[model samples]
Target: MGQIDGWEINCDMGEGFGRWKMGPDEELMKHVDVANVACGFHAGDPSTMVRTVRLAKQHGIRVGAHPGMPDLLGFGRRRMAIAPEDMYAAVLYQVGALSGILAAEGMPLNHVKPHGELYFFVQRDAAIRDAVLRAVRTFNVPIYGLPTPQMVADCERVGVELIPEFYTDIDYDSRGALVPVAESVPVSPQMIRDRILMIAITGQARSATGTTVDIPLGMGGFSICIHSDLPGALENAKAARAAVNEVKKGIRISIY
Candidate 1:
């Protein structure tokens, strides 16, 4: 087994709008280091944002913005063709709203991680990537996602912090990058635990095709992500925490 000196767990929270709620935010918060609060675009309302921010504060976790395409019907998972200008504006507006919520709660906005389709779109489209990166730079907060070569270069050129992330609750491809989920399936706590151990300790993951993929976790500059909307989110978080703690060997794990 490989060794990890330090790591942090992050989760998406506050994804409900109006009367509808999603995920066990409270329980998951206890096991994570950051909360990616959904803005009003994809999911979450003004009140939900504030409440989620408050919850993050209470749990002593950092708060980040989870901006998505305004596709609430599809939970922001559906890809939408968006103009560069519009994408920039949407990201800016959503991030600003969440920043306001954090400011009101006397908390700082730690990062900006795009949610759902918007997240993947930025990686593949240069125009959208530039727009989104430009918008994120305005806030001067780190951006969280996969550590692609282009992403690294863009973030460096734009002068924004880049925190490469690994998705433990989802499957990866031969490249060790997450493959989009087609359904909300429950990932068992044991499965999650095994995945975290492999990622944090070895800096490697098994892909869907049974290929072993390499990640940069061993190089430090990486983080773990757990999808709150996924089935068994709370259990997954617990399992991850336990696995990290075991690796830590009584030493405190620092949340970057």
Candidate 2:
């Protein structure tokens, strides 16, 4: 796909295991363009994955594989010290599994986005970033994450598309890294909408410390991510989608 002139709304979906569920996925799917389906490592089971894909298909939303470290107990948010080789295999394992399921449903894997700790880890570690980028390249699809310089360099080296992402449900520090969820204050839907508009219009994010952090919206435009695990997720997704669409209408932005 070419660079989107407009923005894309992507929500982290299918993050539940077994009978227990998280987020208002059905409602959120109606508003987002892409669904980052969890691939059995962090929180999704086989049934959840299949169901989420089907739901996305029913809503005409694209599906992406959301791979994460094998930290189910920590919900894949806790950082771990795994070897690069192990990280590579783990990523490939998850992406392949999700692709197979999508194939069965006659759907193509649109992209890959690392979940939680794995996403942040790749930002600072060159070895792991290379390993993860290599695995994503094997799938021949775009990878989504924060646009750190190291990640951009690794993507260029591996010849894969890297989609920049901004989180509407979390806080960021001056360095553009996400503030630990435990320490961040709650954000309302209006606040989330404001943040989305800031990135789409100004290409900057207001950090928690009230510092203006630079946010590069790459040539592929950018994606706004809303965590489905947050309270009132449905309202947040609606607010974010509204903000992106309104901006596109005014500026003639085209969404991919």
Candidate 3:
């Protein structure tokens, strides 16, 4: 809850709508430690949310709320100008929905993570970030997010724990910005495993321009993220899990 030791693998799940689905969530659940569950705004319906939480419980994994903008048609990827009040309401609405679902399943809502464009919006806008943090404070749970300078400060200001995350299947650009994960392109599991080791051992990574970016693994730990929608996602998750285990035994595999 407050501060945990070591790293954990978290994957987005239950991103399906009704009978339609996006990723192999059932199989993917076996490889990750936590599930960022959709709360009906981006991709999940009420029934889908229940099924997703049950899947996490089946795997004996933790559950968290993944709140996104009200852009279901765009899958919550489209950016929008939202008022701070609106952001607060949307976060609480979605998080509360999933919290109730977790209650029925007898599992506590472990954390809150903004989805898609909302994730960036909170990072770039202080007002919206404050709004979202206020809503999260109600549940008194940690947040899975990037540890931007302002974000780290704000989490401390609000008395909430911030679990910084790094991506195993995504890359950074020359400017140190994350190159978005392309769902259609296939990334080799070997490459993904190398990335996991590279960052886990050094706490840093090289961007496309060869810029060294420091990843904030606070308290000597991190929450590693692997997207479920990427091609060869299950293999990637397995590779990442294996690489994490290797790191646990004081083994450092460098991609250099």
Candidate 4:
């Protein structure tokens, strides 16, 4: 869609298990600018990781590492009570694994985005947040994070390039953390479009509780995240891509 109307499409891919597949990554690769390939912890195996990286390269899509807690059963959606040091080591281990795959394929990791529970943990825990930043800095790559005040400050403090992220398929609390899908958070295409436009136009989202909350929108540089686990994810992605393009053309949403 970037080619269509000057916007980029990004997707979370490579979330498959030993013999269980997840997304139509091979087909979806044709339509995105970036692919956040899962790194074994959450959902992916060695073979799946290599295949995803290779496919991403073949399609000329920017490849990124998507690391999460080691929870195959919960798919990393369940929070783990891990120590900060352990979280740091887990991140480093997963990132290293994915980096090895990318290196072997001659494609470097472009960014790192923690998945599921790890994402939520970092939103509130300073120690875990610092550990994640430290791990990312060790790899010297950009990090994708929710657009929260602490997240921004943490990224800056650690000297890691931060990409403030928005979600098209998930709803957020007044605090900016994603409301768990299990909680039956309802999100619609129009709602998502309106939220994006509001951020583009005013840099805020009216929370479910009707409170206006800041949405960083990168102050001008932001990347939207679309989770493949959502129902009708492909269609939602298409709608989001089109909506962003429309807003950019109609209102000139700046990304600087």
Candidate 5:
């Protein structure tokens, strides 16, 4: 296999607030290529956000904003029905906050990847997607999203770059939607490696319902996301990267 095929290992970091901390961000950072620093809405305060961005830069990893709804209690994973304008404002607030921090640190945001429920919502809801698109349009950064044709079309309509991202730590349904992580889906390191290999080799995935769904892999443009909050996330990411490397040596896997 040629090293031209590259994968990006990204993680959600800086999700702590006040005195409460979440996950081993520093340890996880050593294994990931990109760090999606959470804006204050869902989790993280100004101090945390700034620190996370600085740390990512020090580690030579690409930094991006991990925007979410204003649902701190649910950790921004609970679905919230809101107007398009509100959605746009919320995204702008989050992304702008991170962008400022990045600018102050002399680092630029490489992309934007919505967190938790907001991610799934935008994937299926055109109105919500448009809101996010509008907010991100003000900035010159790529939008990381699901690799669906509709999403690509939406990005094109907004004249923004779209980096279709896939998750190696999550399951997909027959319809190609992410199987909610709350559904107790079994995800192990081996299974994750298998899924990545399947996508890299076949450009598709066998869904939980035993149906083969077309995935936009090997299309010369796509990215992979591995969440840091999941159990054994670091190990799984290392394994996935090792597998990708074994199949194709000297390939540079970017984190953002």
Candidate 6:
């Protein structure tokens, strides 16, 4: 299946582990269309997952799985050597748990988006890509990821719909590779707004060196992501929401 048309912002949710918290998800939910919720492997506990799913339901947002490597202390940001089978099993387990919670809430699993290091691993490791693709086949949902050449071809071959995710709050290098979020510094709210507007209108993002890099954000069925862990994430979402509205009204939107 193809992605839903028009621009959308999918934000990471359910990151808090037990009593520890992360991000302003409650207020931020009002500004996004989909919530990429954390499964147990990364940062969420069972209670956190249930609470996050309920919050998304209240906002009328689509619920998707954000499974990560089993690295809670590291927040799943550390890239480690993992077997393809291990990757597949971790994904299945995490997605299954989230799906169960969604089922209990009378909601559907909207999609699956691998979180943290695993998300970028699809670009680096062929095995990881195949493992993720296999899980998508099992779940029968769209996958959110970067529109790298190999990933695009693999998704086409495997017959899984991939939502090319353009990250509004993350930094990209000159060659358009993502800068690790751990190294990210606080950015001004205006810069964040400008990036969204520019990308929404032109399908290009500014590189760290101030050059325009073409992104594969198509006319429709594409998604822009806002990481909730970013400083002023609520403000970032507000900026994204405004820009998306402007883009929608700027032209005749062709929705799927």
Best by lDDT: 2
lDDT of each model, Cα atoms only? 0.84, 0.86, 0.84, 0.79, 0.80, 0.86
Better model by TM-score, 3 or 5?
3
Residue-by-residue lDDT tens digits, candidate 4, 1-256: 0111124557899998888989778777765678888999989999999999989989998878899998999999997789999999999999899999999999878888899888889888999999999999988888877767788888889988877777756766787567766763666766666766776677677766778777656545667777777776676666677677777679555331
Q: Which stretches of candidate 1 lie over 4 Å from their true place?
A: 1-5, 183-186, 250-256
Instruction: Give the least accurate 10-residue stretch of model 2, judged by summed lDDT.
Output: 247-256
lDDT of 3 by residue, 1-256 (tens): 5344467899988998988998899998888898999898988989999999998999988999999999889888887988999899989999999999999999998999888788878888999999999999989999988887899999999888888888777777655456654422346898778777778767777675668777666665668888887788899999988888888887645675
Q: How high is each candidate's TM-score?
A: 0.92, 0.94, 0.94, 0.88, 0.91, 0.94
Q: Give a tens-digit lDDT track for model 2, residues 5-106.
A: 348888999999999999999888889999999999998989999999999999988999999989889999898999999999999999999999999999
Q: What is the overall TM-score of model 4 with all chains considered together?
A: 0.88
Q: Root-mean-square deviation of each candidate, in angstroms?
A: 4.6, 3.3, 1.9, 4.1, 4.5, 3.4
Instruction: Summarize candidate 6's per-residue lDDT along 35-140 as a digit string, tens digits.
Output: 9999988799999999999999999989999999999988999988999998999999999999999999999998999999999887899988998889877888
lDDT of 1 by residue, 1-256 (tens): 1111247888999998898999999889889888899999889999999989998898888888999999989999898889999999999999999988888889888899999889899889989999999999999888987888888888898888788888888788887666887732347888787887776555788788878898764366567888898878898899888877876674433321
Off by over 4 Å in 2: 1-5, 251-256
lDDT of 6 at 176: 81
Kindly indicate the candidate among 1 and 6 with the higher lDDT.
6
Error of model 1, residue 251, in angstroms: 9.7
lDDT of 3 at 139: 93
Model 4 residue 203 lDDT?
68
Candidate 6 achieves a global lDDT of: 0.86
